[model samples]
Target: MPNPQLGATSLLTLLIFPDVKPDNILVDWELDEQGNQTVKEVALGDFDLSLKLIDNQPLRAPHAVGNVMWRSPEGQSGKGVAKPSDVFSFGLVCIYGLGGGDMLILDAATIKNLKDHGMPAEQEIVVRHFLYFGPLSQGLLNHVADETWHTLFTSAGSIAEEEAIDDPDARFERWPKDIAPHITPEAKDLIIKMTHLDPAERATIDEVLEHPWWSVGVHNG
Candidate 1:
């Protein structure tokens, strides 16, 4: 039934059956209360749906209904999950979120090259500035220039400069402080660990769980 407190009213009702030729179907329902709407769980053979009702309005379009047969471990009946598929999906989501869905890290490498040359340093500086904003992929730049690693660190405060090159934890220096609130501490820790230029020194997932941000509940969600 619809919760009267939320001011919602169902205007229609529907039922679903898997064995049915059309697979999907719709039906009409009546509402006894003024402007009252409620959702009722209904099971029809291999399918399931919610039936609801709305106030006395003209009977218009039919409501949509779908079937549900199998049930997964989480009680989701439509689809099943495989361990390998789940792992693969997690990897994809991680890549998409970190790189802003952009696959061009080539620009990043180009800027690193320009910093290698002796021309005005500001040009390379601009590239490195945006690198941390997302993952950089191949062929994103207009030209190839000599760029250096130090150019990426130009914004480094004195503390960053002193420890960045030598410390395993220095990748945190890449993040701008202004966006700190937007980043959960666990995420920050993961980014720091994952972005380590020296892959050998990066922190593992188990290690990241012990980070201050994760320990304090920032990653609970």
Candidate 2:
């Protein structure tokens, strides 16, 4: 039986529209060699048992050059980590979870190699990011810190100055085709909004929650 605490009142509700609450959103955990478990919830605010309510705040952290796949373009380019960066990571998670994992630029074999061996060269990761996101716009590129811009474009050979042209339409057009036959149109729209190349243009968490994709299976009954 589905747990009512998980936000579904009945089997029908579980099949239709299931609420995703922060109480159920596991942030991190550690498993001991003895099979002990330590879990950490992403609790930013109060959790009221009386109402089963959670007031969550956007999690923030200083940007770090690790986990190339989950890092946003701005993060890779040395921008400070913020809520929008989390949105980008969430988009990647959605893509992977929605049977579009193969759409990413990094192949399974390469990923396995990296995991078994060690971190791939930074330049290799940058190249993969370029292949995944295409070229960045000139305005966005200019906004990136000087050292990061120079490293990605000059040292890493991931981008060229001539490639920095604005073509927002192409960006949106390319992603859907890459992940087609698996993802719904609504999922694609939400992913695009969540993963906008420019952090300022990325959708907020509230917007993501309100997207039509979340309502696709909802029923009035």
Candidate 3:
């Protein structure tokens, strides 16, 4: 067998298969590097620059600085329709990489508490939080739960409001507010376009990378 080849930079990309168990999707990735210097099963870039297609859902982790990885389910018809369902999951990834709060952590906490005492709606709220705000952002946790999400959303018509006013030419401007603040106003607008509640309004991976944020960073490589 051929030995694994290393890269010029401390980076490598993996494409996970949808049917593969999340824990087992490591074949395409190299985990032997010292300190795991490269990223593990998570997003590590700012924008969705690479396009990975899988046959099943991928597990997710919360975000931190300097993480940018993204995945999407297969097509839109037949079995592929389920692929789009994975879009929601991938959306959460975008949020995390963008520095959105540890929502899965918060959601798990919320669920455990509810199991001991609250109503079903409490859990629903968190789920909705994921469905709505989970995608398109990695920093919403700081803003949404800041005792100011409502205020900010209302005032800004989503975080992109301010960003849109400034750039006027960004793509994320149309993305839903649920996940916009992690990026700059310009980036925020691009995210807005990606998270448009109407999936039709969202940007495809090909288009997303063409946005300013990715363009500025891509050349650095």
* Model 2 ranges off by over 4 Å: 1-66, 105-122, 150-172, 175-180, 217-221
Q: Candidate 3: where is the Cα deviation over 4 Å?
A: 1-87, 103-107, 117-127, 130-182, 217-221
lDDT (Cα, tens digit) per residue for candidate 1, span 1-221: 22211221111122111122112322234555696543443212323332222352211122211211111111111111122111222222233334322321225555567666753333332222223322222211211111332333233223344444454332333444342444554555555454332222335333443456534533342
66 in model 3: Cα distance from truth in Å?
25
Model 1 stretches with alpha carbons more than 4 Å out: 1-174, 177-181, 215-221
TM-score of each: 0.25, 0.54, 0.38
Total colliding residue pairs, candidate 3: 27
Per-residue lDDT of model 3, residues 107-126, tens digit only:
65665776778544223332
Q: Is candidate 1 or candidate 3 better by TM-score?
A: 3
Per-residue lDDT of 145 in model 1:
16
The digit string of per-residue lDDT tens for model 2 on 33-69 reads 9997654333222222112112332222244432555
> Could you tell me how far off, in angstroms, the CA of residue 99 lies in candidate 1 after the best superposition?
10
- Per-residue lDDT of 92 in model 1: 24
